[model samples]
Target: MPASTPVAHSKTAALARVLDAIPKGYCRYTQGNVSASKAESLARKFHLRYGIGCTPAQRVTRRKRGMANALLVMYWPEGCQQVEWLMLATDGQGMDGEKLLDIADKPGMAWLGYELVRRPDRGRTAWTWRRPASEMAEHYALIAEFGNKHHTNSLGSLLQRLANQPGFHGVREQSKRLFEEARRRGHAGDLPHLFYVQKVSHGEWLRLG
Candidate 1:
């Protein structure tokens, strides 16, 4: 479909429609070529509506990992040609916590994972980070604040903000580590604006450079 085409419903509705259209047991992979083909089709539909690319090359199922479930690999494109993976549940339901952790623990791909569930009744989608909420309360707050201000909740945006806050030396360091890891994983993005710590009589603050 043309990217400019007006979707009949919101993006979330489109996602729900795509997922709901999948045949029962299609996620099992045991359904054979029919299932695989349907998955690819649905993935493409999702990509068109959401601007997140999903192709046959990026598809991975539980069978591939020796697990007894299904997974959807969705990629979010970044400004600097970087793409991050989000392993979503194939059944339209939220993913299991243990299952998500198991996938994260594996040595292959590093993903910024989340459980996205389509709420047909609510006419939207709900998102929950795979990590524990308590462990990331502060980061979540920061992300929410940034999203509220800039209308985006992308990790890159949060990292950019952190990189500009000199008072957050630890966060800045963590951002560097994430950037390096992203680069190592072939997910390099445009460099965020640089900032420096400036000293004053009252206290220290961030000074954009």
Candidate 2:
């Protein structure tokens, strides 16, 4: 399908199936050829969406990698140069890598994007992933704030701690405190613009705008 065409629900489902069949390993799996064409289409859509030139050679390479990456790198074609999107597989072993397939067709999951997901095994490791850290120090500083708070309760507790800090009368105060905290922790940017402040029974609660 052309890049301009609206993606259909059925097509998305098919893409999900294709993604599901992809084996997560260093060695190539022959079984995936059944969906090679569809997988190639999905890959083209992905690279094209990002303005990556899709030459026949690059196309073949991407097709192989799409069907294969612990760390797949794509260098832009000449005159179409751009920063590469790093496709890092979380696991060197295939066990955790298989979890990536689960991201397919889920709500809030991008078809061609990496995501964070808990493994189904007893350990429940975070098999999915996040975007690469920003090169900008300021942007990375904000990301540092909640980088380790993956659990809902842990995150809520952190927020509650911030809310309970003294001298906070409202959401603005809370947000300002957050900015100050980020800055204190090495955020080099200006006060971040927060768009919302929610009020609770006890006091004003900070909600990211």
- Candidate No. with top TM-score: 1
User: Model-by-model lDDT, in order?
Assistant: 0.34, 0.33
lDDT of 1: 0.34
- Residue range 1-209, candidate 1, lDDT tens digits: 22211121122222232233233232311111123324335445434433223223333443354332333332322222322223333432323332333222223222232222222236654321122234346665554554455534365665676455432233344456555643443334575755433332211111211
Total clashing pairs in model 1: 0
Worst 10 residues of 1 by lDDT: 200-209
Error of 2 at 198 (Å): 26
| TM match of model 2 to true structure | 0.19
Clashes of each: 0, 2
- TM-scores of all candidate predictions against the true structure: 0.22, 0.19
Residue 184, model 2: lDDT of 54
Error of 1 at 137 (Å): 9.8
